[model samples]
Target: MRESSSSFPPHNNTSNAIHKFWNTIKCCSSSSTSASFLFISLFICTLFFTQWSHYIYFPHSTSTTNSLQFSNWTTLSNNNISHDYPKKDGYVLNCSSSKALTITCPPNYPPSNRNHKNFPSNQTCPDYFRWIHEDLKPWKKEGITREMVESLKEKAHFRLVIVNGTAYVKEYMKAYQTRDVFTYWGVLQVLKLYPGALPDLDLVFQCHDKPSIMKKQYRGWRAFVFGSRDPPPQFHYCGGDSTFDIVFPDWSFWGWPEVNVKPWVPLEKDLAEGNTMKNWTSREPFAFWKGNLRNGPRPKLAKCNSVNKWNAQIIDQDWIKESREGFKDSDLSKQCVHRYKIYMEGNAWSVSEKYILACDSMSLLIDPKYYDFFTRSLVPMKHYWPVNTMRLCKSINFAINWGNNNTKKAQEIGKEGSKYIFEQIKIENVYDYMFHVLNEYAKLLKYKPTIPEGAVELCSDRFACSPMGLETTYKIETMVNGPSEQGPCELPPSYEPLTLKSIHDQNAKIKEQVLAWEKENYGWSWWTWW
Candidate 1:
C-alpha cells in the first residue's frame, strides 16, 4: 500500500511541475511583447525630436525641402494632417503672403523711357542739351566765369573751342577750370584772349572744318566773329566783312604771312605799345618787307659752337633720309635715337604744334624761327636747329626783352643776349630753360587784363559770334561740294531707316532663347537678389 501511495504522489508532483513550466512560458512571452512596443515608441519620439531640432536651427533648409516636395505633387487636394504623414515642423512654415512672393516691378524699370524724359527735348537751341543751368555748372568750376556765361547769352550762341593740334580736349579741359579755354592753334590764343573777356558764351565747339549748324544758328544772331584767317564759307551769305563784326586773326611774329601782321614784334613791345599797336598793326606787303622773307634767298651759315647748328644740318638730314629708305636702310643706332627723340617744327605756324611735339622728350629741331619758339619745347636744345642756320642766326639762342625796343640799341642788346645764351647754355642743361619757360607760362594765367576805359566796348555783344550757324553754313558748302584741285572734301552718306518687322523678328528669337533658359533654371526666381 505504501509503494502505491508514493507512485501516485510522484505523478501528482510531475503534473503540477509541468503546469508551472507552461505558466512561466506564457508570462515570458507577454513581457517580451510589451518591451518591443515600448522600444518602437521611443525610437519614433527620438526621430521626431531630431527633425524638430533641424527645423528650428535651419528654417531656410527645411522650407526649401518642403517647397521641393510640394512642387512634386500633381494635385493640391489633401487638406488635413494625419498621424502617419511626415509632420512639418511649425518653425519651418512660410509666413509670406502670395503678393509678397510675386515679383513687384522696380521703380527704375523701362530705363529707355526714363532716360528719354530726363534728356533735353529741344535739340535746336544751344541750351537744348542742358535744359537747366545745372548742366552747365560743372564747366564753370573749370574756369568759365559768370562774365563768360553772360557773354554767351548776349552772343546768343555756342562758343568755339578750336583745337589745331592733336591735343586731348579732355585733358586740357580738366587742367583748367574754365570752359572758355580752347586748344586751338596756339597763335589763336592772341585773338581768343581779346574776346575771351566777354561773357554769354555757352558751348565750345571744335572740328577740323566748321559745321553747317554754325551758319544756321548765326542767322538768328546779329553778327559773327572769327579769330582764324580762314573765313567760314558762309561769310559770303552774311555779307563778307560786314557779316563778321570783328575779325581778330590769330597772328604772331612767327605765324604765316596771311595770318599774322608783320615785324614779328616782341611781346614786351606789344605790351608797352598798348591795344593800338596790338590791334591796328596791319600786315606788311611782301614787296615792302625789309626783313627775311620766304621768297628771299636762304640765310647763310655763320660760325657757332652750338652742337644743334651742326647736328640740325647734318644728323637730321641723314636721319630723315634713312627714315625715307624704310626699315631695312635704318641704322640700329639711328633707329634707337629716333625712337627716343621727336622732330619739332618751329617757325611761322601754330604754337599748338610745338606743344604737341614737346609732350615727349628727345625732340629734334627742324628749323629756328623765334626765341619764343624755343620756349614751347620741354627739352629744347641747340642740337634741334640746322647747323648753318643756327651758326649764322643771332635769334636762335637769345631771350629778347622787347619791352624796351626804343631803337637799334635794343636790337644790339638782343644780339648780345643771344650770344651770351649760346655761350652759357649747354644741351645737357637745356631742361633748366624749359622749366623756366613753363613756369612763366603757368604764371601768366594769374594775370587779369586791366581793361582800359575804352576796352569794354571792344568786347561788346556787337562783336560776339554764333558757333553753330558758323559751323553749319560751312559744312553745307564744304562737305556737300566735291573735292577740288586744292583738296578732298565730301559729305558722308545719309542714314537708312529700320523697319518694325525686322526689329520684331530679332526680338522674337532673343525671347525664345531667354524663355528656354528660364524654364531650365526655374524661371525668374534667380533674379530675386537683383
Candidate 2:
C-alpha cells in the first residue's frame, strides 16, 4: 500500500507469498514423519540383532546337569560287534551292562527280605567242582565237567568284559595280586561263574574301588565294583550316581577263596564242615570273641574282661602271623564251641560277620554304627542281640545273662540268623547281584566304552594272560616278607557314658548366660530408650 508495484496488483503478490508459506509448512510436517519412521526401523533392527546373538551364544540341552560336571558328550553305537569288543572310543572294557541299568536282582533271583523270619533250616552246599567245571571250562581241566551247551540254558546270560586301560589294568593287576586271598579269588570268581557274553559297545567294566566321593573324577561310561561296600555319607544312590552306580556286596564277605578252591560252596562248608556237631545245647554256655584289639572298641571290649564271669570270655587276638603259634592259632572252626559269639567292628566292615553267624550261635552284636551292603537288613533281637556301647560291659553282661536264662529263645535266634544268611548270601546270589548291577550301570553311560589315553590293554580272559607283571610279582614277594603292621587309629580317651552332672552343667551355663544378658539390657532400659 505504501509503494505499489507496476507488474501486477498488490493483492496478487500477497496471495502468491501466502501460497509459498503454506507449502513450506507441509514439507516440514512430511520431514518429521520420515524422521520418526527412521527411528522405529533402527530400533527394530537392533532388537533382532540382539535376539539372534543370544540364541547363538547359549547351549541347548535336555539332560540333567547335576548328574555329572561335564556334559554334551556324544554316544555312538556299533551294532555288529560282539563280546570282547573294544570300546568305540578305542578303549578296551570288558562285560558291561548290555541293557539299561536296573535296581532289581537278576532273572529268577529273589530280592532279599529283611523281615522274612522263616528260611531254609538245612541248606547244604551244591557240587562245587561240578558247578565250575561245567560252566567255565578253564584251562585247568581237572575240574571241568563235559556238559553240553543245553545244560546252561536255564541260567542268566553273562559276559566277562575286562576293561584294560594301560593304567587301569596296571592298577587292577596290582590289587588282584596284592589283596588278600579272599579278594583275589572273589574277583576272579565272577568271571568263573558266567559264560562270556558277546561284548557290546554300550557296556564297560572298570577295575577299581570307586568310592562315591571320587565321583568328580569319574567319566560317565565307566562302572566300578569291589570287594568292600561303603555307601556315601548322608547320600544314597537309588539307581545311578556320578562315579560307578552299582555296588554289589563283596564276594569275600560270604566266603574266602583261599579257604576253598571251589567257586560255589555253602556257608556251613565255608566256615567249618564240622560246625553242625556243635549245636546251641552242645556248645559251652558262654560268649566268645577273638579278634585284634588294635582299632575301634576292641580294646574297650578286651578291658571289659575285668567284668567277666563264667558266662563270657572275650580275649585280645593279634591275628598276625607272629602272634600265632603256627599256621593255626585260634582255629576258626573251633569258634562254634561257645554258645554265644560276639561281633565287633574293625578298621572298616569286618569279613567275619557271615562266618560268625553261620556258626548257629546267638551273635551278640556290638550295636554297629556302620553297615555294609546287607548288615543293616538283619533285624535286631530277631536275628541277633544288640549291645548298647554306652555301658558296654554292662550291656554285654546283660545280653549274656538273657541268653543263659532264655536258652530255647536264644537258640531259635541263632538258627534264624544262620537261616537268613544261608538263604540270602550264597556265592550264586553274589554273582546274580553283580550281573544286575553291571547291567544297570551300562544304561547310564553317556558314550560307548572307549579306552582312555595312555591306558594299556588288558586281556578279557584270565587264562590267556599272566596274573601279574614282573614288577608286580616283585612287589608281592616283598609284601609277603614284610613285617605286618597297622597304622594307629584316632581313638577317644574314654568310651564311658556322659554323667548326668555334665548335662546339667551345660544347661546351667546356658541359663546363666541368658540371665546375665537380660540383666545387662534391662538394667539400662530407660536410659537407652531415651
Candidate 3:
C-alpha cells in the first residue's frame, strides 16, 4: 500500500490562480488593448463554466473553504445551476439532473451472476458481513442526526447523499491519490449491482488515512461544540483505537494502479489461478516479502532476509522501478510462487493483507494492530500462521520449520485461507458487503436525506470522466455489468454479547498458543513493537 511516486503538480487557490491566468493572458497578448479585451472575456467564461477538479491533494478542510475559493474550478452547489455545465469534448459533467445522459439500469446488458434458483430462507452471509452492524453501532440508539453530520462538515472530505437511487458527493477537499474518486466509484458500483438496496442518507466520509472521531474528543471536552457529541458517524477506510470511524472497504479493492495493482475482480482470478500454476511443494521454499520496508515493523522484517538462515526472501520494493516497467513487475498474481508470503502493515492497516491471504501461500502475518473491513472474521490458525512482532527472525523461522514438518496441515491452511479470500470475497461478495454496510447505516439516519448545498449528482457517466484520465479504463472494466438476479446473500444476525466475547477470546487464545510454541523453541523475548 505504501508506494513512492512523484505527485502531479499542485494547483493554486482562487487569487493566485487568477493571477497566474492573468500572467498567461498578458504573455499571449500583442498589446495592452488586446490584453484587456481577452482578460474580460476569460473572466466572464470562468464564471459560466464548471470544471470537475480531482486528484491527490492535501489540507483541504472547512477552515480553508472561505479563503481558498475555486478560481479555475467552479463551486458545484445546487443554488447556482441553470443547465448542465459544459466543457471541452470527451469530458463528462455532472448535472442537477442528467438531461444529456439518462442512465437506464439493466440496459439489454450482458448476463450477470444472478442466482436463478430460489435462495434458501436462511441463507446466511459470511462472518465479515457482521462487521457492518458493529460499524454502525454508534448511531444505533439515538440514530444519525443532521446536526451530528454537519459537525463533521468542517472536518470531513466529502458529504455523500444518496436520494431516490441517485448518488451525489459534496467535496470539501481533495483526497490522497484519488482515494476519494475511486471510493465514490466503488459505492456507485454497489448501487448498480444491488439496485434499491442502499437507502437515502447523508453521511460524511473522512478521506484521510487515519480515523479522526475519537471518543474522548467527541464527548464534549471542547467548549465551542454544542453539547456532548458522544459519537459522530464518520466513515473512513480504516479504524483507529477506540474511534467511531466506520470502516468500509479500502480503495485498493477497486485497484491500486499507481502501485501497478489491478482491481479485485481480475486480480482475484489471477491470484487463484496463479496458485494452480504452482503447488505449495513446487513453490520456492522461502517466506517471501516484496514491499516498502519503511512502514510499521517492516524495516525490522527486512533484516530477516537471509534465505539460508531464516528461509526469508525479502525485497526492499522499488515502487519507482515497478512504475517505470508499466507496473508489469507489480502484478500481484505473478508473485505467488513462494510457499509462504509475509504481510506487514504499511502506515496503517494495509490493503495488501487481503491479497496476501488470497495467494494460497501460508500467510505469515505479523500480529496486526489495525484491521480493515474483512480481517476480523479471519481465525488465526485457520487462516494464517501468526508471526511474533518482537522476534521477527526467530518467529518467521519457527513458522517455516513448523510448516515444513507438518506439510498436510500447512497445505490445508493455505487452501482454506485462499478459499476465504477467493470464493468469499469475490466481486459479488464485495458488492454485497458494501450494500449491507450502506443499507444498515442508512437505517440509522434520523433525518430525511437531502442534497447538500454544493453537491454534484454522481452517476456512471459523470464519474467516468477523469481529470487525470488515469483510471478511466480501469473504472469501465470494474463496473457491474447489470443488476443481479438475486438479492445479497442473507446477513446473519448480530452476535450476542457472550458470542462476540468468545470469538475475541478464541483469537487471543490462538495467538497465545503460537507465541507459547515460539517460546518453547526460542526464549521469550520482550516485545518492542513498532
Candidate 4:
C-alpha cells in the first residue's frame, strides 16, 4: 500500500535533465527556422488537409478533385423544387428535397469576355438605299450624250461643255450643240461631272445658283435672262421681242421688285436709314446678286426665344428654337429639313419668269431655282408682293402674297390663299402635284414654236426637253461619231429653229430702251453676230 506511486509524480534529476535537453533542442531548432520557411510548411500542410477533406466530403465533384476543371454554378427554383441540386462543373454535394432542378452554365464553362452576347455593328447600306438609287439614276442618265462621249477621247481636243444659264435663254443653243453632228464640240448643259473631263479637260458642270457657280466656273457660257412677265409699267418685255439667237439682260429685270425692295417694317427702315447703297452692297457681285437679286437674303439664323425681324415677326419662338436646334450640327438630314422650308433660286431671265417657274407650295418663298433645288416632297410659299395680279392668276397655284402697298388687301389675299393651300396641298402629295404640273407644261411644250420671240412664243419647249433630250443628243453627237473626227464643229439640225415673229413685236420698244440704257450706263453698244 505504501509502495512508491510510479504513475504519480516523482521529482527525479535524470528526468529533469532529459526534459531540459529536449527544450534546448526545440529552442535551437525554432531559432534556426526562418519565418518564411515556417509559413510555407504550415501552408502546405493546411492545403493538403483541406484538399483531402474536400475530396472525402464531395466525392461526386469532379471539378474539386481535378484542378483542370473550373465552372460557375447557377441555382434555379421551380414550384415543386425548394432548391436546385443538379450537378455542374464546380458543384458540391448538398442535401435538399425538390421535385425538379436544373443546373446550367455557358457551353465552354469559362466565358472569354463579359459582354460576348451583344449585337455587332452593321456595315451595310440603310433600308432607303434602293429608293435613293431609283430616284437619282434616271435623272443622272439624262445628261449622258454623244458630245460627252467624244469629250472622253484624249486626242479629240474637244471637251464636254455645260452652260449654266437661264434654261429658256440658253436652251436653243444648248440643244443645237449637244447633237450627234456636234460631237466634236462636246457640249452639254446640266449640273454634273463628266468622268472624262477629269485630269485633262478639267471641265466643270454649271449650276444656276451663284453660290454653286462661284465654287467652279462653268465650262461653256454664262448668260442672264432679264425682263418679267408682269408686262408694262414695271418691266417691259425686251428680250421677248428680240431677233438675236440669245438675248439676256443684267440684274434689274428678273423677279418681282418686292424681292429686291427693303422690308416695310419700321426696324428695317431704321437699319437702312443711315446705310448707303455703297455701304450695303457687297464687293463680290455674285454674293450681292445672289442675296439681293436672286434668292432673297439667306434666312436669318433662327434665334431662340427671340423675335425674327426678317420674317415679319410671324415665326413663332418655339418654331425658331426648334429649327435652330435641329440645324445646330449641320447634318444633311437636318439641313435638308430646314432647306425644304425655305425658298431657293435658280437662274432666270425675267422676274416674272422666276416667279412663274419658282412658285411651289412647299417652298417658303419663290425664287428662280425652286424647281431644281426644292425637288419634291416640299411645299413652297411665294414672295408675291410686287408681281402683277393678272399674271399671278394664271401662273402659280400656291403663293404667299406679302401684301401690296395696300397691306390690308394683301393680308386678306394671303389669308384666303394660305387656307386654300393648307387644304389642297400637303408635303406628302407634292410629287403628285408636280407630276401633274409637268404634264400640263408638256402640253405647252408641244405647241411652242421653234423660235425666240416673246415670253409667250419663244419655243421654250427646248428648255423643258433639254434636261433629258440634251443628254441623248450629246451621247449621239459625241459617242456615235467615235474618235474619228478631225475637228470640232456645230451640230447639224439637232434643234428646231424658233420662228414666231408676232411675240417679238410686243417687246420691241422695251428692247430699244434696254439698248439705250446699256449704252448710257455701261458705255457698251449692242452687238449680235447672228
Candidate 5:
C-alpha cells in the first residue's frame, strides 16, 4: 500500500475504488465464466431501471395502460363493487367467505312501486268507455233499426226485484223447463252489467220455448217481464211484439268471466299477427270446417265436402261425448294453418263469427239468416267469401275454387277481416257496450227501486245475485214494466232465409215422442199436465 501511494502519482480516489472492484470480480472466477455472468446481471439491471424510469416520467400513460390489463384488479379499484356479483348468464357468483343472499332480477325490470298511490285517486264506473244502442252491429244495418233507448225513455218504467220463497222460484223453474220462458242468460247478462239498476223491483223473464213470435197471446203470461229473446221472421212464437220492453242479445258475444269460458276463439294477444302465413301455398289447399251438425244447414254442409276441386273437411262435432272423455278442445290458434276456413251458424247466432274472421285463413262464410250486434259492416268477397244456401254445395265449391286460384286477393280478404275484428270486437269493448245499454235503460226508470223480500241487496260492487250456482238453472224473479202488446216485426229481404221445414218437422216428432214417453210412465194425467 505504501509503495502504491508513492507510485500512483495523485490519481482520483473514486476511480481507484471502481478499478479495484472490477479486478476483484475477474480474480473470483475464470475470465469466460465471470464475464458471461457479469454481462447478464448488468443487462437485467438496465432493463428494470429503464422500465421504472419510463413509469415515473410518463406516469399517466404507462401506469394506467399496464394496470388495466387485469379486469379483476380494475374492479377492485371501484369502491362499491359487489363481491358476489351476477354473471352474464344471470346467476350470481358468491365470492365472500361469510354467507350472504343475493337476488338477481330480470333485465330492464323497474324497481317495485307496489305501494305507490294511484294518480287519479278514486276510480268509478262512469270513467270508462261505453257502446251505444245507435251504434248498431255491422250486420244489422237495416234490422233492429228502431232506437230502443229512445223508445224506452218515452214509454217505459224500471222495476227490479228479487223473488224469494221456494214455491215461487219453483213455479218459474217449471215455466223455464216447459220452454214457456227463455231469457235466463239475457237477464243474468243485464244484472251483471247493471247491478245498481232497479235494486228493489220484482219481475220475471219469460219467452216462448222456441224461437217464435206470433199474434197469439201467451197463456199464464204476467203483464210485465224483464225481457224476451229471438228476432223477427225466424222465431214466430216470441209474442214479444207488445208485452216485453227489454230485448238484450240472446247471449253476449264475449264470454262470461265468472263462468270461466273464454271467447270462442283464442285471445287476440295469444294469436299470431295478421298475414303471418309466410308460404300460403304450402298450407292445406282445401277449405275446412269442424262443428256440431245440429242447426239449419250444417247437415247439408256435411254433404258438400269433396275430394275433387272443392276440397274441404266437414266434421260433425259431438260436444257431449267430447265432454265425457274430458274435453279435448282444439288448439284454435293452430287452425290458421289451413288456407281456407269456413263459418256456419250453430243453433242460432254463434259467437264463432269473430273467431272465424280473426283467423288469417280466408273465410268461406255460409249465408246466415240471423245477424248479431256486429256483422252488418262486412261486405261480401271483402271480409269473407260468401256461400249461398240456395246452391249450398255449389257455392262453397265455387268460393274455394275461386280463392285457390286468386290466392293473393283471398289472403288480402283474410288479413282485412282479422284486422277489422281485432280492432272492433275486443272483450273490453263488449263490456263497454253492455254498460252503455244499461245506463241508458236506467235513465228511463218510472219508479225508484227498493230491495224486495228474500232478496239480497246489490250495488255495482257485487258480481252476481245470491244463490249464484243454484240460480244459474232457475228463473230469476226481478221487476219489470207492465205488459203492452207490440205488433210483429218484419225481417229484411237480404236474410237469404233457409227453409226450416225439416228442422221443424224433426222437433215436432221429438215433442210427440216425449209426450208418448210421459203418457206411458205417468199415465194420461201427467201427459195432459205437461
Candidate 6:
C-alpha cells in the first residue's frame, strides 16, 4: 500500500527557509566530499532569492492574486438540486443541472469564453494516449451502460460528471491524505485550460493507489450486466497490464504539498534551470536514490547504499524529520547533483519518476510492475538504462561503472530523457491526455450522462483557488494562466495488433540486451571483493 503523508506538518513554510538552507550548505561544505555541493549551494541560493517569493507559502492563499477572472460556469439551479442519488455508492452532477457550491470567488473575475485558441494543424499528441482506446476496449463490443457505472459505486471514492465542459463532483469517501481533493482540482484545471473540449461524461473515479477492478470478475458478462457485474471499466490513478483499470497521471502533477513538493509547472521549470547550472561531467558520480524505503523494492535498495559495494548512494527518507526541518533537505531542485539517479517503485509506480528523469542525469530505471500514463512510452536506452531485479546491487554497481566509463553515451541518454519529458509531457500535453482520455471514454457511454442530484459544480477559481488548504496554495501557484493559446494536439490512431506486439517485443529485446551485456562483461558468480 502507498504510505500516507500524514506524518508531515500540515503547512510547508518553504518561503522562510533561508536559514535552513544556510545550515544545509554549511553541512555540505563541512562534509567535504563531492564538489557537486558547491554547485547546488550556489544554485539554491540564486533561486531562493529570485523565484522563492512567487512560491512562498501563503497562509491566507487568496492574498497573492488580485484579478478575479472566471469562465462562464454559473450553476443552473433546479428544484431537485439538493436531492441525493438513492443508489448505494453513487451520486453525480449534470453539466446542465449545475448547482454551484457556496465557495467565495473574486467577485470581478472575467468571462471564460474569450481568446480561445485553435489546435495547430501540424501538431500530434504523444504516443501514450493510444492506450485510452485499449483501456476502454473491453466494453467496445457492448458499449458501457449506466448499470455497469452504477455497480462501481460501491468501490468509487467519488463521482465526476462533465457536461458542456463544466465539471460537477460528488464525494462518497475520502481517499488517502488529499488525493481526492487534488485529483478533483487537477480535473478542474483541465477544464480551465481547455474551456469547452471535454464532452459530457460520467465516471466513478477512485483515488486509491491500486486497481480495484479485475478482468476475471466480469469474464463472461453479457452487455446486460447489473448485479455482480463484470469488472467494468474503472478510472483510477494507476495500473499495470495485470489489472484492468484505466491509468491517468497521478495527483503529483499539480503538487504534493504533504511532501512540500511544488506542482509540476514551477517545479519543472526550477528543476530545468537547476539542470542547466551544472553539466554531466561536473556532478557526483555515484548513482543516487532517496525516499521512504518502507515497501516494495525500496528496502532492498538500502543494501546498495555503499560506495565500494554498489557504487550507489541510497538514503532512507525520514519524512517526520524533513517536515520538522521546514523541508529544507526535501527540495526536488536541490537533489539533482548526481550524474546518475535511480528510479525505484515504492509499493507502486513512484511519482519521483518525472522528477528523476527531468534532472538531466543518466536515469537508472529498475524494472517496475505498474506504470503511469507516460512511462509506457519510455524507450529503454534512449530514455533510461533499465536495471535488472536480480543481484540488485551488482546490477546498480555495473550501471554506475558503465556510465562513468561511457560518459558521452550516458549524458546523451540523460539529455534525451529530459528532452522527452520537457518537450513531450509539457503541461499542455498533460491537459491533452486528460482531454482525450475522457473524450474517448465519453464516446462509449450508452446512456446520456446526468448531473447527480447532490452534485456540486466546480470552477478552477472557486474550487481550486479557494485560498484555504495546502492543496489550494499549490493550485494557486500552478493554475492555468488563461485559455490555452492553442488547442490540444491531435491524438494518434490506435495501434494494430501486430504493431502493438512489435513495440512490446522491441522494448523486451532492449532489456534483454542489457542483461546479456552484464553476463558477457562479468563472468557468472565472480565474487572477488572482500
Number of the top TM-score candidate = 3
Tell me, by lDDT, which candidate is best.
Answer: 6
Cα lDDT listed for each candidate: 0.23, 0.41, 0.71, 0.23, 0.41, 0.72
Each candidate's root-mean-square deviation in Å?
39.5, 31.6, 8.5, 33.6, 32.0, 15.7
- Tens-place lDDT digits, model 6, residues 1-530: 46553432222344456656767667544666557767776877775544322222211111223322222111111112121112312112122311222343332232354323454436788888888778878777778888878777778987898876667766665577667667877787777667766678999988876677866555555424544544677798788887789887778888776667777877888899889778889999889988888877688898888987789999988877886676778878888899999999887777888999999999999898888888888999999999988778888888888999999999999999999889888888888898888888898899999977666566554544323345545666666666676777788898899988999999999999998788666775557311
lDDT of 1 at 512: 49
Q: List the candidates ranked by TM-score, beginning with the highest.
A: 3, 6, 2, 5, 4, 1
Runs with alpha carbons beyond 4 Å of true place in candidate 4: 1-383, 387-408, 416-420, 433-530
Give all TM-scores, in the order shown.
0.17, 0.47, 0.78, 0.20, 0.45, 0.77
Clashes of 1: 40
Q: What is the C-alpha lDDT profile of model 1 across 1-530, one tens digit per residue?
A: 00011110122333554566456556554556777768755765554433322111000111312221101001111112111222322112122321121222223211111111122223121111111122122232344333432333222222332122101111111111111121122212222212121211212222211112232334433234432222221100001112221111121222221111111222212322322321111211000001122211232322222334322221212322442343233211112211112222222223322222221112223343322213322122222222123222332222111112232442232233333323322221222222222222222222232221111111101111211121111111111111111111111121223533454355445434533443443344445312
Per-residue lDDT of candidate 4, residues 1-530 (tens digit): 01111121222433554566456556554555587568756765554433322211000112212122211211111112122122233211122211112122223311121221132223332221122222222223243233333332332221222211111111111111112112111121111101121111111122112211110121223222322111110001112111111111112111111112111122122222322222211211110011222123223222211222222112212322433354233211111111112222323322222222221112233322222211221222222222112222111111222221234443343333333333323221222222222222222221222212211111111111221222222222212111111211111221112322332343344334533433453344344200
Candidate 3: segments with Cα more than 4 A from true spot: 2-6, 9-122, 216-229, 465-470, 524-530
Q: Which ten residues in a row have the lowest lDDT in candidate 3?
A: 72-81
Query: What number of clashing residue pairs does each candidate have, in the order they appear?
Result: 40, 15, 1, 34, 30, 8
Choose 5 or 6, whichever is better by TM-score: 6
Residues 1-530 of candidate 3: C-alpha lDDT, one tens digit per residue: 55332443334354566667668767664656866787678884573232224431111223422222221221211122122221333222343332222322232221233332243224578888888887777778889889888888788989998987777778876666658877988998776666665678888898775677777765644623746755778888888656788988888777655555667877777787888889899998889998889876678988999999999999988866765556666668888898899998877777888889988889998977777788888899898999887778989999999999898898888888998897778777777777778888888888899877656666665545433333654566676666665677787778788988999999999999998988877754455322
Of 3 and 6, the candidate ahead on lDDT is 6
Candidate 5, 10-73: lDDT as tens digits: 2233345556656766675565676688785786565443332211100011131212110000
